[model samples]
Target: MEKKEAFLQQLSKENQKAQYHVMNLMESFRAINSTLELDEVLKKIMHFALNIVETAEAGYIQMYDESLNKLIIKTYVGFNENISHFKVNIGESITGKVFEDGCFRLITTRKEIYDSMSDLSKENFDFIDKAHHNNQKIKSILSVPVSFGAKRIGVMTFHCFDIEDGLSETDLLLLQSFASQAAIALHNAQLYTEVHKSLDEVTHLSQRLKETNALLEKRTYIHNHLTELSVQKKGLKAIIIEMNKLMDRNLVYADYLEGNYVPQHIKHFAKSLDDIFFLFTSKTKPAYVSICDTVQIDCYIYPIRSGSVLLGCLAVEGSSPLSQLDKLIIEQGAPILSLEIMKLRSQTEIMYKKTYETYHHFLKIKNPQQAEITAKELGIHHHYFLQTALIELDGNVDLHSLENDALLLLKHLKEKITLENSLLFSYNNKITLFSSARDAVSEAYITKIIESSIKWWNERFSVVARAGISTGHYYPGQAEENHLKAEKALLHLKKQKKKGILHYRDIGISRLFLQHPPEEINSFLRETFSLLWTGQEKKDDLLHTLFTYVQNNRSMTSTAKELHIHANTLYHRIKKIEDILDMDFSHFEDYLKVQLAVYLYKTFFGSLTKAGKLM
Candidate 1:
């Protein structure tokens, strides 16, 4: 009876211990499910698991990381913070094996856990072993898979310091039950986290959609504004003012063709506007926008162009970068601006043609009544002293280019002389300009004007040209006489072998040659140089030497210098001339006759032969 009682007492002690564990398990279930916090729930689960397995001193809950494909320690107790970040791959370590196999592992001895670790895990294990606090060491391990329904979520591991107190089968079973509850709580917490994240993402996307709609509306407004600006039928100033107001900036505009400024009420931005002009005229791009530096705030420049020709530019001063909409508006406005420039150009050209026709009529008419009518239409004062000039370009240039250059020169003349009563036209490869000054204007003043025009032509065309000015002051009806005199003066100036301005009065005795018939002049030249004209080659050399000799006042040395030949060569030529003519050098009569013949040949018949000797 005593043996049976002792056995019954021992069974009672075992039953009481089992009942205490059941109560602890119930308390753990309540504590772990108290909150939906995954981290807190996991911590409670680990604490309860270690409590139920009384001898275990350290533990950790490792959840499966789908992204890393590894088991990462989420909650831990009795381990250093660095160890809490430990990670294990599937089938790699004790916790990884339980997660991968979805089963419980009760390692009763240190050797069992160490033998199951891979070479990689052994290294990690050594690191974790050294990190144990208070000189404690891991002797046993019990790892159980934490699952929700059929899916395993993670592994809960418990570690002991003494082999004698290592985990038993009962401990593994109790921990597995705790893991089931932990898994459900962890899965619920995960779902809650993902739902909250999705809601935040939706909120962010909605805000972005609102912002994009507002931006689209703004873009539409700018497009409509630009379209309206493009359709307005008005002058360039009105258009540019509207553009300036739309852009909300200080705008300065120029029309290169008209030489007019927009906003006629504002002060001229002369210095600042130069940059815009230079860029527009120099650059070849059809449209361009660039940052420009100026006296005020820096600005953006948009060149106004049609095709390849630049009409002008619109300069806007502001403190912001030009947006795409701003650039588009400027580009669209360019055509409108170009149209205005072309219209102004056409009107000016028409006015110039009318004036040119009136002047032509004035030059052709003889009677005062007709001349007065044409002059009045041409806007020329009948009593003003009018002078005619003819400019002849000396080159083998293209006819079209020549005419264009001539027109440019005429424009420059009007600008330089600041004269409004000037008429210019191209006829017979010559640019003819008729300019009028007041009766009080001096001949010297008129000569200065002609000189300035010639100088301007030289600087612009980089070519040799000559201008002939009429000397006789005439009324409107006498334009024909003045124009004839200017032409005669130009012909005489060519024989002098000099370029630049020449006046009719300077021709002097050449006017007498002009009075005689061409046949009479030819006969005079032939009789004067009869002997030298016998042979073509010898005649050319002798006549040229004689002309140079006479031009230098019959001095042999000066003649040689002028001809760029040696004095001996000049002397030989002179001797040849004397022999050919059979005339004595000592006779003044013979020298006078030859010099007069040379002068007559040069004045009238120089253009007919190469050497200016009548054939």
Candidate 2:
């Protein structure tokens, strides 16, 4: 009966200890895996390992360092600093052998512990022995492999020094189970680290993608807005206004042909370019124009062109550099602006063609009633008397270039004529202006309009032109008559080979000569200016002298002064002229005949000079 009781007590004590160990191990596992840090995991594993097992007096945990091919002691309890420096190769010591074999080891005696070490590791053992210095002599040892799979991680070891039955099967099993948990904890830490790193990368990429998508959406919006503006048929002025609003900056469209800007308010940008018309046509790219001299500004210039033909340029002004989005705005806006310009130009050409037809039709209509109806149709009422001014470009200019100039001049003149109540049209090499003369004083106003336009056109557009105005205002019945007077004045001004405004009243009896046929004019010029017709070397000089003498009203002293020559020199020139003409200038009839011939020759402006022989 006593033996049975003792056996029952022993069995019950074992069950209680096993339950304690299992409960302690479960708690330790929860603590061990709480963090992902390798170093912290090692500390918790060592702490919980010692706490869970009663037999273990001192303990250590080692991790495999593949580079050193060694099991390095990482954490310990009841050991000196010398243990940290203690390293073991595979199968070198008890710890190494357990790691290498992936099995548990039981060193029940000190001799077994010494024999478990290889000869190569004797120095390491001696060093550890010396550190102990006979303090708490080591008796029994238990070592277990820390492994997750087939791969060995490290070794966990415990010792019971000089205690009979202090370590047992339960201790070995518990230690082995703890070693497995340590391996699992280490691996979980590594996996946790990798997951967090991957998450950070994904988050960064997502932010960048979001920003990129936003920028793309903004670009699409700007492009569509520009396209819609063009589709709506808004003109250049509307484009500039919207561009200024969109960019929140100053923008202007430069019209090279017109030598002006669309919005006259900001036309000062004209000076920003030295010459964008020629400069931008060739570049065909966006560039910076430094306008630092006057306003301390840096404007971005995007050249607007139609193939090789430079229409103009679009200018954005700012002291700061343009953003990529702003530059994109310019790029998209430029093409739409080009289309608008081309549309306006096409519309302008069609309108000019229609106006030219109207001009010719009204000038040719002779019936008063029909003229009045046509004039009313053209917004020319009966209350307004009309005067005409004719502009004839140089005969040698390119017809295409001249036509372009005439279109540009028409716009320029229309601006000047706005308040003056005048209208104008351009033909092949001519631009004609007609002003509504409310009274006699308005004729001079009409002359002033043509003169100012000619002066401005010649200066700005590099076009040379001569203009002639009518001598009288005409109602609708005499529209043809007024146009003739202006035409005759221009022809006479052309024969003078001058650049200025000439009124028909100022041109003398040259109008009478124009009434004759071209052949008659040619015949008359050939016979009268006969020396000039024969290609005499002094023909030009003689003709110039005779014309000057005629202009001086046939006064010998005044002619001498006007010719910048001595009276004797004038006499000799007159004598030479008389010799060439086979006539004397002393008789009034002879002087009168010579004067008429001279005037006729000076005022003949027709095809009679195609040969370039006669004056």
Candidate 3:
């Protein structure tokens, strides 16, 4: 009867325990469902798991962190020490193994736990050591897979300090049910977190897009405004000023000039900012440069170019660095500036050509009515005394290169002379500048201009130029005569192998001799040098040596030096010439006659030969 009473008491205790477990599970469901927050739900799940499993002294919930590719302890309860810092790989420790196998792990003794962990790597062993140091000794353990559907999320582990019959079968089953509910709750919480994060990202992206659209609108407005400014054809200065106003900044522009027109404002600015323009023009493209030391301003320099031709440079100066929009404006403005520059250059060239034509007509036309009309069109008075300068290049320079050099020289001369009465033009491969003088221009002053021009040309193009100046002032109608006089003087100077400048008055008797008829002059040359004028191989040598010897005042040594020949060769040639002519060289009359014939031959016959009329 006592055994039957004891059995009834044991059955009543079991019933009471079952009822408590049912109540605890119901409470756990309500607690886990209370919030969708992942951390809170995980913590509640871990709390309920530790409470329902009475043998467990501590418990932890680990979640798979996709980014870390590891199972990290998300929440834990019941331990006197913290093991929240622990992490597990997918298939590494007991928890990892349970997660990997998607099943439950039961270790009934300390030896079983040690055996299970013995094969683990040093990192896992360190984790166990840390737990041991925390006084959370693990004598028994039960790790169950926390999964949703077929996807294993992580592992839920419970630890005990004392070894006992591992969890009972009913307890294991209840823990698995708890794990399923935890898994569902944690999965829902994770979905809610991801959706919320996605919504926040979408909101942030929308704000950025709006800002981008507004910026684009601003750029478009600026671009359209610049386009409108470009179409007005208000000139470069006006366009640049408008651009500066639009940017609300001061911009200093300077051009390299290069025989092109430069506005007066640009010239003044260039003078003020000479050092900056020099440094900026040296660059081959658009760039940002620091001119703080030179001009005390930060500026951006953009080269105004037209396909390898650097038209000029546009410099924008300010106290602050240029923004990307400012840079874009300059970039867009460069081509427009280039087009305007090219247009202005074309107009200037056209005006120059028209002026040249008028001057040419005034010199060539003999009709008084036509001459007066052209002179008026040329903006020149008939009474102005004009002096002409004829510039000729001496080399095998091409026509195009010569024209370019002449244009540059003319520009420099105009700048230096700065006379309103001067007109410069390129005509027949020569640069001619006609200067008006109330009285005769001093020979010294004209000489100075010629010498300075020669030096300038040599420094620029590494070439020599000879200029012929008419000696005296003349009426505008006598321009042709003065032009002819200058041409004769130039021809005389060239025959004399003179350089720099030559005046009509300096040619002496050659001026009168050059005016003689070409036929009479050729006849005189042939008659005087009958023997030497023959087209023989040695005739040229004999005549050349004779001329050189006479030119050196009959000094054989000086003649040899000038001709770059030995004195003995010159002596032999002189003797041979005397023999050929059958004349006495020591006679003064004979030598004087030969010298006069040599001068005439070069002055007249040489001119005809150059014109391809005489052999």
Highest lDDT scorer:
2
lDDT of 1 at 83: 76
Instruction: Give me the candidate number with maximum TM-score.
Output: 2
**Which ranges in model 2 have alpha carbons more than 4 Å from their true place?**
1-251, 255-294, 303-312, 319-333, 392-404, 418-422, 425-430, 471-473, 513-580, 587-593, 596-615
lDDT of 2 at 415: 76
* lDDT by candidate, in order shown: 0.71, 0.75, 0.71
Candidate 3 or 2, higher TM-score: 2
Mark the 10 consecutive residues where model 3 has the least summed lDDT: 606-615
Q: What TM-score does candidate 3 reach?
A: 0.49
lDDT of the structure predicted as candidate 1: 0.71
**Tens-digit lDDT track for model 2 on 1-615?**
999999999999999988998899999999998999878998999899888767788888888998999988888887777778788888877777788888788867776666666454666886566545356666788888888888888888887875745777878888878878889998787678779888988998999899889878977998888777778877677876777777756777777567667565243455655455546645777888765455566677787766654667777776578877777677778888878877877787788689779977987888999988887666676655678888877745457656655666676677767533555777777887766667877777667877987887666544578888885656776777877888888877766677878888887777776557767866766677776555655666676777778878879999788768899988898899888888788888878887877666655542223233343
Q: Can you give the TM-score per candidate against the true fold?
A: 0.46, 0.50, 0.49
Model 1 steric clash pairs: none
